[model samples]
Target: MLLLLLLPSALLLVPWAGAGRIIGGWEAQPHSRPYMAHLLIRNASHKFECGGFLIRPDAVLSAAHCVTGKKAVNTTVILGAHNLKKKEPSWQVFHVGHWVIHPNYSKDKKENDIMLLKLKPRAKLTKEVSYISLPRHNEQVKPNTTCKVAGWGWTSTTGDETSVLMEVDLKVLSEKVCENRFQKKYLHQSMICAGDEEGKKSTSRGDSGGPLVCNGKAHGVVSYGPKYCVFPKIFTRVSYFEPWIHEELRKFVLQDLPDSPSSD
Candidate 1:
């Protein structure tokens, strides 16, 4: 039974993971989902540490748990690269400026697991790099509706990370099934549960913080799932936190950030 859980169980919601693309999925067209952002420690490990998207020219949205205990000065945001392993002309890397984690985020509780990254000098937008629109605060796609998830994470739970972007489509499971599978209060308005109940395809480890694109908008952030990515995947509902995101962006990220090349 696929269910939401308070414990992320090593999938996501634990600090420090790079959300790779989809497992049991197909490669994404080059530059598709251009808002995809890769986070890592510069000159550290060649592996990306998390996945994010450009909500603004200077701002990125990722999992708070992924960046916890790490300094913004030490992090790098890689944008416009479908393949991180190669040097692509469209790729641009930026250092982080503001490290804003949700004030109520609880590592122990594994709830409210989201954060914003301010790109130093902002990010340059090109044909290969663009933005994803956020789901309206009250918008929602019904259960069983198909949504797409993309990432550069592992193609399998134990497989090597894919060098290119991958994509998979998943159905939104009903809340009743989610309630039965997870603990009481595990499913909340701020969170969403969806996946293949048949154990065929889903995002696994190294795919945390990626976007769950539904109805051509970003409605969820890849949070976590079962060990093998079989169980239903959990996502932080973007609609529920619309105010929190806007408040922070309006107060901090909007001011004093440099313009992207396209914007200028």
Candidate 2:
């Protein structure tokens, strides 16, 4: 009777709750391909990892949440390598000089989810530690365009975390489809959507703040996803935030580039 009805409802709710945790936390399948570098944050006692890009010799751009609301500045940015669990002497470990989280960053809405880290010493640009080009201002990528996303986050809906960098091909979707899928939650002008319609390849939990690069240029930063970790990955559009990025870069130049002109 009533007990049977309630039991069925409880069973139905179990999967939803578990799905929420899997999609919301740092857990997923392992990816096969690697394309991005991740910055591992380790304090004296605790250790946490996040994704980032070597945008310059002296600066690494990542999500603000990755730096702020964390432990002391014993952070190390691992460059040129992906497998964190392995011991690779070739990978560089940089001491963090300073970090700047976007002033307008909102944890609830995830607005302005960008951050910049200054290394104690400048890293040399080579075949491995090269900088990725940022998108130009006013550049608008149309829907259905193919793009690539890479990170060291989880791979599948129920898989182990990845030690090596993982990359997947994604397709940009229309804002309308994104809004409908996510119910317009945190989907704004500064963000765009990408992924497969059938939940093929997409960003999952712990993939936040990674690069959604397209056309050899970084176009978005991983932001949010849907209930089942399916398609339609919401990404913060880099082009819309070009001005802020330039301003931040200028600040870095002023601090790091003593010989260069202040106007840079």
TM-score of 1: 0.85
Off by over 4 Å in 2: 1-35, 43-46, 257-264
What residue runs in model 1 are displaced by over 4 Å at the alpha carbon? 1-21, 42-48, 70-73, 257-264
Q: How well is each residue in 1-264 modelled by candidate 1, as lDDT tens digits?
A: 323333344443343322344767898898978899887743333434678888888788988866665433377788998877997999999877566788988776657888888776767888888889998886777998899988776777566678788889988887876665555535568778888777668877666788888998888888765443456777889999899999987766436546623211
- Clash counts for all predictions: 12, 5
- Candidate 2, residue 99: CA error in Å? 1.2
Q: Give lDDT tens digits, candidate 2, residues 13-108.
A: 111111111122232233222224567677677765666776777777777766666675577777767566885655677767578888888765
Worst 10 residues of 2 by lDDT: 13-22
Q: What is the lDDT of residue 167 in candidate 2?
A: 68
